[model samples]
Target: MPRLWDETVDAHRRAVRAATVEATAELVHEHGLRAVTMSQIAKRAGIGRATLYKYFSDMNSILVAWHEQQVTVHLEQLVSIKDGPGEAGARLCEVVTRYAEITRSSRSPHAFDFPDLHGHEHAVAAQRRLRELLGELIAEAAQSGAVRDDVAPAELAEYCRHALAAAFELPSDDAVHRLVAVVLAGLSASDARS
Candidate 1:
């Protein structure tokens, strides 16, 4: 009887996980992360609060899972661009642009949105990985002379990231591209004509 009970519990847990993913994806798509709530997810999933809690400790866990999934997709995209033939700046621009597009398209939740991961180990690790990748790419672009050397590669990468992420708030893609050019210019050597 105990073994049978354990099996049933495992099945229930699996069901809740599937429901959580579905509900989270839907809520984020429809209402954005800020508007999503634990209670709403539970109701949408047609599961009791207790059942939801049994599978996920809270909304933060679910959001983190979603972010992990998104990151997996983004990583694949980055890998393809990293290997693609092109100027370093163009490739880097492609990467940043795609990343910005992905973020803009989704109402997906960010790591900070989850209270449970506010200072979580996994969150810190993920951020570190992101910074390392950004820094490497920026440094590469600088070495290729496509980006200026005055500013640190990591700083350039971060600036590009921020600009792209906030692109939607800007008036146009032209504006965003111009902003990127400005950052690149700042990194380049001074313009001197003979």
Candidate 2:
């Protein structure tokens, strides 16, 4: 095939895959994972069942691919926040706030198995990278005396993660922000010194 023809084919394949992934997520969110089927995905994606099968072996595989894409996008967004214009402490505050916001807003009704999906190796690796990113920010803030250095940065990162996860249960944006403030306060060097 000519180069232009190859590019067109590749683009078409990507479009098909993206559509399939999107349709799968929507179907699963609406119908629950156990109730969803490959046929429904194909119909929603505007592709035939045979074509959908050519792209994914089963609904589970499609869900995994969709989740992987979601994780990658989320990682990229956090990385962008880390690299945004700010000092380390400022960036950390912004990233932590944004992360709490993401967690707080992620409510949805789905019957999918979270441990199976989120515990996938790719998801685990992304989570580790996020932890490392948070650790780096904490280390920077510690060196600058913005946060406590009594605890190791990695441990502090873990603490921040656990504390901020409470945002998911918070009732309102005000509650979430208050939770972030508490997390940040706990990390403050002055609080430790007092």
User: Candidate 2, clashing residue pairs?
Assistant: none
How well does candidate 1 score on lDDT at residue 46? 95
- Tens digit per residue, CA lDDT, model 2, 58-158: 86788788878987887888899887787888888888998898777665556225336767889899879989999998999899888898999999999
Off by over 4 Å in 1: 1-19, 31-51, 102-123, 150-152, 158-168, 188-194
User: How do the predictions measure up, each by TM-score?
Assistant: 0.61, 0.85
**Candidate 2, TM-score vs. the true structure?**
0.85
Which residue segments of model 2 deviate by more than 4 Å? 1-10, 28-35, 111-115
lDDT of 1: 0.69
- Kindly list the per-residue Cα lDDT of model 1 for residues 52-167, writing each as its tens digit: 88778877689777666666677678768866899877887777666665645443244345445426565466556656676787788778877667778787667765656665
- Each model's lDDT comes to 0.69, 0.85
Best by lDDT: 2
Pairs that collide in candidate 1 are 148-187, 148-188, 149-187
What would the TM-score be for candidate 1 when compared with the true structure? Answer: 0.61
